[model samples]
Target: MGETSKRKRKRNVSLTPEDITKVFEKSMERASADIAKLIEAITGGDAMTRLGVELEGMGLDRMQVIRVAKYFGNKPNQLHIHIWNGLNDSYKPDFVKAILEE
Candidate 1:
């Protein structure tokens, strides 16, 4: 029966800010793992010096570097686009290619 009666009531519904925070926290958790793996790849014994120099030359600090890695780890096939669009002219193409190859 479609009987329409105006009744004002407060129901528990998801709020925008709450939803945003929940998603943000979830993503942060995933990014942590991505960052850890990327950090290991960057600072591992053999690649340490070259990796540090290349990242530093691009003027990115540690956190930013991790974020970039997380971004790439999330969608590595788009590495070329990310390197070109995100790093501007600070990074060497060959260096980026080498890292992506690894």
Candidate 2:
């Protein structure tokens, strides 16, 4: 019985590359929708001028700003802290300071 239980536990589920790709694509689509909704909520439908301009003024390049926005968009709470911790140290302090000042 012990050996049978071990064998059952050892069964592995395998995913094909195509399966992985499909899952990834679905996840990306969901994430993109969430980010867009969050941005709209934050900017009140004025994303280009409000959020974009502000982050740009903070000296974050396009990609960095996108990354920051992803954090803000996806995680309105503690999840953002984990994302923030993963940010590069170079701009992290400045970004935090500027945000806090607001």
Candidate 3:
């Protein structure tokens, strides 16, 4: 194993500026799509502006968004669990569905 590790060869390939630009563009596109999906699921039938307004004061990061969705069911509910068990790892839409069902 040590001999094989020492014999490892390096492959050299240089990416041109255009190649870098294309890679960056693809990554940005994917990231944008994912963010859009997350936001869409979180907002659902509600207007994006509403979410923007609520998130304004709260600074709803990913975990906070999950927590709010989990406890609140994307609508007001009376079930108040004050503990953060980190069980709200489900994505926004699933969390909303689970909470509503519960």
Candidate 4:
């Protein structure tokens, strides 16, 4: 028998601050003029469940997902290394848009 080994996959997708900002803006596109509604809409909503299967695939717990939302909603200026390192590009916009949706 021959010995074989599987390689570990690494996501090397590095997002610049601008890229993060772009994604954030896209997620909040549905926000209207009302600040309260905008915050409510973005931070907590049915959007999280929108990613159904993708949630399990990404291994993101509920709080982490909420944190992602809050991070985008409130602190778009900061570099959120945790979510950035944990999720790749694919799991990003979809997750954010899920909550951002009306």
TM-score of 3: 0.38
Candidate 1 CA-lDDT value? 0.56
Residue-wise lDDT of candidate 2 within 50-76, one digit each (tens)?
545666777777777776666465554
10 residues in a row with least lDDT, candidate 2: 42-51
Residue 80 CA displacement from its true place in model 2, Å? 26
Q: Which ten residues in a row have the lowest lDDT in candidate 1?
A: 1-10
C-alpha lDDT score of every prediction, in listed order: 0.56, 0.65, 0.52, 0.55
Off by over 4 Å in 4: 1-57, 76-102
Candidate 1 residue-wise lDDT, 1-102, digit = tens: 233332323344557998899999999999998998876655442333444455667777787566545544556354443344455454555555465456
Q: Which segments of candidate 3 are over 4 A away from where they belong?
A: 1-10, 45-102
Report the lDDT tens digits of candidate 4 across residue range 33-93.
3666765455443333443444445677787666655654455433333354367767776
How should the candidates be ordered by TM-score, best one leading?
3, 2, 1, 4
TM-score of each: 0.28, 0.37, 0.38, 0.23
